[model samples]
Target: MKKMLIVFLIFAFSLSAKEVPSSGEMMFDLIPIRPLGLAALAIGSGFFVLSIPIGLLSADPRQTLEQSARRLVIYPLHFTFQRPVGEFYGYMEEIEYVSD
Candidate 1:
């Protein structure tokens, strides 16, 4: 019983001593901002829009273009959609599994 009490006191003291990373400091961590990814996403969307004109003008691989469009849209969307819930895949904040 004494050992358990001592352990509890030590644990409490350690928790008090530990400083949490500020939410602001970890803001980008949750959403991993990538300018390049955003740029590519924009370019892909632009090209997909341009392809619409080409498709209207002549023969075009509609199926292939659809696949490419999906790929392009999905990559950056992945960052937006996947980065938040790092532990679970969709929720906002990361839940700590192990506490100090």
Candidate 2:
């Protein structure tokens, strides 16, 4: 138990001493943001599946499906995986361009 505690303390100190900018942000992103993003992706995918029939039935199925897919599914997927660690704004711009 004592040895384990010492190892844990060392690991914690190492994390704090790293040169990475916004380590706190990275930790926050890793611990909560990523998981929440994944959850959003899952929930959005489910919603997209449910919206499929409506999209197909719309006056313009292609447009409806494309918009819905981008909003509900692709956005979360990109935010979750493609965004750089500790950097938040770039992915939104990318997605905006893609949507346009």
- How close is every model to the real structure, measured as TM-score? 0.39, 0.72
Local accuracy by lDDT, each model: 0.57, 0.87
- 1-100: candidate 1 lDDT, tens digit per residue: 9999999999888843544556764455455555555776788788777776665655556755655566667555555444433222233234222323
Question: Which structure among the candidates has the greatest TM-score?
Answer: 2
lDDT of 2 by residue, 1-100 (tens): 9999999999888854544549898998999999999999999999999999999999999999998988999889989998878767755584554345
RMSD of 2: 12.7
RMSD in Å for candidate 1, one decimal?
11.2
lDDT, model 1: 0.57
Best by lDDT: 2
- Runs in model 2 deviating more than 4 A are 1-20, 96-100
Clashing pairs in model 1? none
